[model samples]
Target: MTEPVLTVTSLVKKFGRVTAVDGVSFELAPGASLGIVGESGSGKTTTARVLAGLEEPTSGEVAVAGEHVRGRSRRARLRRARRLQMIFQDPYGSFDPRLTVAESVAEPLRLHAPGPAADVRARVDALLDQVGLSRRAGDSRPGELSGGQRQRAAIARAIAVAPRVLVLDEAVAALDVSVQAQILALLDDLRRETGISYVFVSHDLAVVRHATETAVVMRHGRIVERGPTERLLREPAHPYTRLLIDSVPRPGWDLERLARDRRALDAL
Candidate 1:
C-alpha cells in the first residue's frame, strides 16, 4: 500500500493554561486534500502552524512521508520545509514589499538550492504560468496586484520548492467569492499536476465542501467529527458540526429562526 504523504497524531499545543490544540490527528494521502474546518478560535490555524513547523507542539507527532518533523534546529526546520510549504491568509503580508512577484517566487527556489539564473527564471515563469498568471504578472509587485492575483503568486511561491504537502491556512478567506472559486480551482489543478497533498484549513464550509476529499470538524481545539466531506456535511453527527452547517446562509434561511436554532444547539 502507498503510505500517506502526511500523518499527524495526538497533536496538542498550549498557550499558558489554555490548550489551543488538543489531541488532533489526521492523515493526507499523496495527491489528496484534507480540510480542517472550524470557527475563528477552534485551533484550525494552530494545527496548521504546528504541521508547518512554525510552532512546536507541546506534545504529539507529525510526519511527512513517514519522516518525523519537529524541533527548532535550523537543520530540522529546513528538512521539514523540503516536504511542506505553507500558504497564508494574507498574500500581501507574506510577500516582501521590496521584491517583485517573480523575485518573490524565485526566492524559495534560490534559498533551498540555488541554480543558474536562466534556469531559475524559467522555473519562475513556469510556476507563474501554472498558477494562471502571465509572464507580465511577474514584473508587478504584490502591492500592485489584486487580492486574487496576489494569492496566485503566493501559491506559485509555495509550490516552487516542489514540496509534497501544502498547508493552506484560510488561504482564500480574504477574496471575493468569484476570486475564491478561481483560487480553489487553481489549487485543484496544481494537485492534479504535481501529485501534492494539501492540508486546507478554513472556516468556510461551502469552500471546504468543494475543495477537500475528507474533512475534520474542530470545536474548541478538539475534533468533534470527521469523515468524507460530503457525508459529514450531509449528516453531521456532532452538534457543533450541525451548528456550523446550519450557520451557512441558504436560499431561504430565516434569520430569527436561525438565531433560535443556534441558541438551542449551543445549549446542547
Candidate 2:
C-alpha cells in the first residue's frame, strides 16, 4: 500500500470554552481526494485550518509526507506552510486588496523559491495559465475580476509553491453551479497532472459526491460517518448523515424516484 501523503490523529482544537474540533482523525493518500462534509460551525473549516497549519491544534498530530508537525518553532512552521497550501472560501477576503493578480500569485514563489525576480514572473504567468486563467489576467487586481476569476487566481496562488497537499476549505461554495463545475474540473486535472493530494471541505453532498472518492461526515465537531463516497451517500449509518443525504437536491424526486436512486446508490 502507498503511504499517506497527509495524516491526522486525535486532532483537537478549542477556542476558549468551545471545542471546535474534537478528536478528529483521517488520512489522505498521495493524489487522493477526501471530502469533509458538515454544516456551518460543525468544525469542517477548523479542521482544514489545523491541517493547513493556519491554526495549531490544542493536542494532536499532523504529519505530511512522513514528517510529524506539531507545535514547532516559527521557522519550522514556515517550512511546513510551504508543503501544504490552502484555498479559502472567500477568495477576495484571503487576498490583499492592494496586490494585483500577478503579484498575489507570485508572492508564494518570492518567499519560497530561490531565483531571479524575472524567473518568478515567468513562473507566475505559467501558474495563471495552469489554472485556466489568461496571462492578461496578471495585470488585473482581485477587485477588477469576477468572483470566479478571483477564486481561480486564489487557486493559482495555492499551487504556486507546488505543495504536496491542498486544503480546499469550501473552495467552490461561493461560485455559481457552472463556474463550480469548471473549477472542479480544473482541480481534477491539476491532481492528475501534479499528483497533489486534496483535503476538500464543504457542506454540499452532491458536490462532494462528484469530486471525492472518500467522504467524512461531521456534526457538532465530531465525525458521524466515513467511507467510500458512494457507499456513505447511499447508506449513511449515522442519522445526521441520513439527513444530509436526504437534503441533496434532485429533480422530481417526489417519492418513488428518491427510493430508486437511493437503492441504486446503496448497491454501489
Candidate 3:
C-alpha cells in the first residue's frame, strides 16, 4: 500500500485552560482528499493551524512526508514549508497587500526552488494559468482582486513550491455558492494533476461531501464520527453526526429546535 503523505496522531492543543483541539488524529494518503468537518468552535480550524505549524501542538505528533514537525530548527522549518503549505480562509490575508498576485505566487518558488529570474517568472506564469487566473488578475494586487480571484492566487502561492500536502482551513467558506463550487473543482483538478494530498477543514457538510472521498466529523474538539464520505453522510450512527446533517439548511429546517438539540447534546 502507498504510504500516507501526512500523518497526525493524538494531536492536542490547549490555550491556557481551554483545550482548542483534543486528541485529534487523521492521515492523508498520496493524492487523496480528506475532510475535517465541524461547526464553529469544533476545533477543525485549530487542527488545521496546528497541522500547518502556524500554531504549535501542545501534545501529539504531526508528520509530513515522513518528517515530524516539532522542535525543528530554522532549516527544518524551511524544509517543512516546501513539503507542506496552508491556505487560510481569508485569502487576501495570506498575501502581502503591497505585492501583486504574481509576485505573491512567485515568492515560494524563489525560496524553495531558486532559478534565473526569467525561469522563476515562467514558473509563476504557468502556476497562475494552472489556477485559471488571467494575466490581468495576476498583475493586480490582492486587495484589487475579487474574493474568488484572491483565493485562486492563494492556491497558486501554496502550490508554488510543489508541496506534497496542503492544509486548507475553511478555504471556500468565504465565497458564494457558485464561487465555492468553482474553487472546489479547481482544487480537485490541481490535486489530480500534482498528486498532492489535502487536509480540507470546513463546517459545511455539503462542501465536505463535494470535496472529499472520506471525512471525520468533529464536535467540541473531538472526532465524533468518521468514514467514507457518502456512507457517513447517508448512514450516520452518532447522534451528533445526525444532528449536524439535520442542521443543514433545508425545506423544513427549524433553527430553534436544532439550537436546543445541540445544546442538549453538549450537555451529555
Candidate 4:
C-alpha cells in the first residue's frame, strides 16, 4: 500500500484554558482529498495550523511526507514546509503588499524549489497559467486583483514548491459560489495531475461534499463523526453531523428550526 502523504495521531492544541483541538486524528492518502469540517471554534483551523507548523500542538503528532511538523526550530519548520504547504482564507492578506504575484510565487521556488532565475520565471508563469490566471495577472499585486484572482495566485504560491500535501484552511469560504466552484475544480485538477494530497479545513459541508472523498466532522475540538464524505452526508450517525447536514440552506431548508437545533446542540 502507498504510504499516506499526511498523518495525524491524537492531535491536541490548547490556548490557555481553552482546548482548541482534542485528539483529532486523520490521514491523507497520496493524491487524495480529506475534509475537516466543523462550525467556527470547532478546532478545524487550529488543526490545520498545527499540521502546517503555524501553531505548535499542546500534544499529539503530525507527520507530513514521513517527517514530523512538530519540530520547534525554524530550520525544522522550513524543511517541513518544503514537503507541505498551506493556502489560507484571506488571499490578499497572505501575500506581501509590495510583491507582485509573480514575485510572490517566485519566493517559494527560490527557497524550496531553487533554480536559475530564468527557470524560476518560467515556472511562475506556468503556475499562473495552470491556475487559469492570465500572464498579465502575474504583474499585478494582491490588492490589485479580484478576490477570486488573488485566491488563484495564493494557490499558485502554495503549489509552486511542488509540496506533497496542502492544508487549505477555509480556502474557498471567502468566494462566491461560482468562484468557489472554479477554485474547487482547479484544486481537483491539480490533485489529479500532480498527485498532491489535500487537507481541506472548512465549516461548510457543501464545500466538503464537493471537494473531499473522506471527512471528519468536529464539534468542540473533537471529531464527532468520520467516514466517506458521501456516506456521512447521506447517513450521518452523530447528532452533530446530522445537524450540520440539516443546516445547509436548500430549497426547503427552514432557517428558524435549524437555528433552534443548533442552539440545542450547542447546549449539550
lDDT for position 253 in model 3: 80
**The candidate that achieves the highest lDDT relative to the unseen native structure:** 1
Model 4 steric clash pairs: none
Compose the digit string of candidate 3's lDDT tens values, residues 78-154. 88898899999998776899999999888888888889999999999999999999988999999998899999999
Off by over 4 Å in 3: 254-260
lDDT of 4 at 55: 89
**lDDT tens digits by residue: candidate 1, 189-267:** 8889889999999999998999999999998899999999999999999878887887788888678877887788778
TM-score-sorted candidate list, best first:
1, 3, 4, 2
Better of 1 and 2 by lDDT: 1
TM-score of 4: 0.95
Worst 10-residue lDDT window for candidate 2 reads 253-262
Estimated TM-score per prediction?
0.96, 0.91, 0.96, 0.95
Write the residue-wise lDDT of candidate 2 on 92-131 in tens digits.
Answer: 9988989899999988888888689899989998999998
Whole-model Cα lDDT of every candidate shown, in order: 0.92, 0.89, 0.90, 0.90
Tens digits of lDDT, candidate 4, 63-130 = 88877776779789778888999998998777999999999999988977677999999999999999
Q: Where is model 4 more than 4 Å wrong at Cα? A: 254-260, 263-267
What lDDT does candidate 1 reach at residue 137?
84
- Cand. 1 TM to true fold: 0.96
Predict model 4's lDDT versus the native.
0.90
